[model samples]
Target: MQLKNKKVLVTGAEGFIGSHLVERLVELGAEVTAFTLYNSFNSWGWLDTLDEKYKKHMEVFTGDARDENSVRKAVEDKDIVFHLAALIAIPYSYYAPASYVDTNVKGTLNVLQACRDFMIEKMIHTSTSEVYGTAKYVPIDEEHPLQGQSPYSASKIAADMMAESYYRSFKTPVAIMRPFNTYGPRQSARAVIPTIISQILSGAKEIQLGSLLPTRDFNYVKDTVEGFIQVAENDKTIGTIMNIGTGKEISIGHLTEKIIGLIGRDVKISCQEERLRPEKSEVNRLCACNKKVSEITNWKPKYTLDEGLKETIDWIEKNIHYFKSDIYNV
Candidate 1:
């Protein structure tokens, strides 16, 4: 289970959390292969921003996760596989549910089949809190019933079920890592934290947002990546689903005010109709019970909400040019 010198392949390595995980794995002396979506620009996504020292430790593979041949090639000879590739935007999923099923569901099936054929040491499949929809109970546990309120959530629910079935039917060494609202420096502007930070940094007097009443348990990206590594390293986590979160919740309205205070700005909140999810699709509350992960692995959130928000604000302030704060990012 020791990662040092282990051959690790991370799907979606170009993404926010995946990039951080790749960097951390390299720092731990793991032989890393970064599998990113193929682009004519040959872009590595967020991984392109990594310094040369870290990049040198990584082998970049450009391919689509939806392609079984590409996924199989990437999984071959890897000691462990971290499956993170997916179409994650909620709004976009609404626009193209079929694409979500193709990328999220079928893409995951590609990885599972590859792992099964190659007999990889382990596979860490990514899951989202969105699959739980609006919480029916406070501090939702792993056993809480999943309610797919949106196409995005439904796609993820299908993907998670596929991973679970692989573990049960084929005895695949797959562990599902479900993270709740992870946000940090490299996160896309589609996410609320980045949306708020970019607007405030862009000197906007009014911040446009969706429903402010919905609550979420946010975890820092670094903490979430740590959970991925810890869950993979622990044999007890095999064939299990672990929730990585802070066991805390905050309303979007309050969260926006907190971010405004951190940015040292006074901004009016404007609820944009286009920004809002459909009434039933909107998840009203989410709070994770980290008991499973805490008991199974020595993992806990290392950053407080305020501390994480401040760090995100600092990063966005420096990288303000990357964001188009005037436009609502779908």
Candidate 2:
């Protein structure tokens, strides 16, 4: 559990959650190799925002997660691997479902294989509450049935099962952490929270969104990062899945109104047909049960909804140019 001096590999180190996790790992004193998706622009995504001093400690390697050779190279001498790379946008998945399968499922298989081959200490695979589909029951626990409401969620479900197989068949010391809706600064515009905030911050009087009645259990990015670390530290989490959430639900309509109030705006809410997910594909509700995670690891959420929203608003206002507020992101 002592992270100091340990070498860690973090796939998707350039993403919203992955970037935050990398920062935390650096603070924990872990020697980090950050696996970023290769791009001609040579951008590091949110990792570019990290302090120069912290960036010095992380070695960045850019390559595709689905590339077995690339993933194999990233795994070398790593004591732990946190695999977070995936095609996460549900709307895009309808157009490019194959990419999700290749990255979310096959990419995870590569990580598991390399971990076993290199004898890594553990592998933490990131899952999502979307795998639970529309919540059949409020406060979904680990025992709740998983129903993939979209191709994107289905791919993630496949990846979660793939990680479990590695633990059972190869004893690869894998843990699955399913996070509910995590939102914060540097989040992509494809996500609902960021989309609304970016538009409102850009001085829009009306916000376009999908279904407002769908409720979600939201977790702040920092709190979700802590949950990942706790799972990595606790031995009991091995071969098991844990939920990270605030244990409260908010309808998208209410959330938008709350943000409007926080930003001191009287924005009209508009439901865009193009923005809505397919009737069956839409997850109408999601509320997580975190009792199991709390029992196994000393982890708890630190941010309330209002507090997190304020922070998100501040970030979006400062970086309004980074967002295309006039267009629907996905």
Question: lDDT winner among the candidates?
Answer: 1
lDDT of 2 by residue, 10-57 (tens): 999999999999999999999999999999999999999999878999
lDDT of each: 0.95, 0.93
- TM-scores for all predictions: 0.99, 0.99
How large is the C-alpha RMSD of every model relative to the true structure?
Answer: 0.6, 0.7
lDDT of 1 by residue, 1-330 (tens): 899999999999999999999999999899999999999999999998999999988999999999999999999999999999999999988899999999999999999999999999999999999999999998999999999999999999999999999999999999999999999998989999999999988989999999999999999999999998899889999999999999999999999999988878888999999999999999999999999999999898999999999899888888898899999898
After superposition, the stretches of candidate 1 with alpha carbons farther than 4 Å from their true spots are none
How much does candidate 1 score in TM-score?
A: 0.99
User: Which residue pairs clash within candidate 1?
Assistant: none
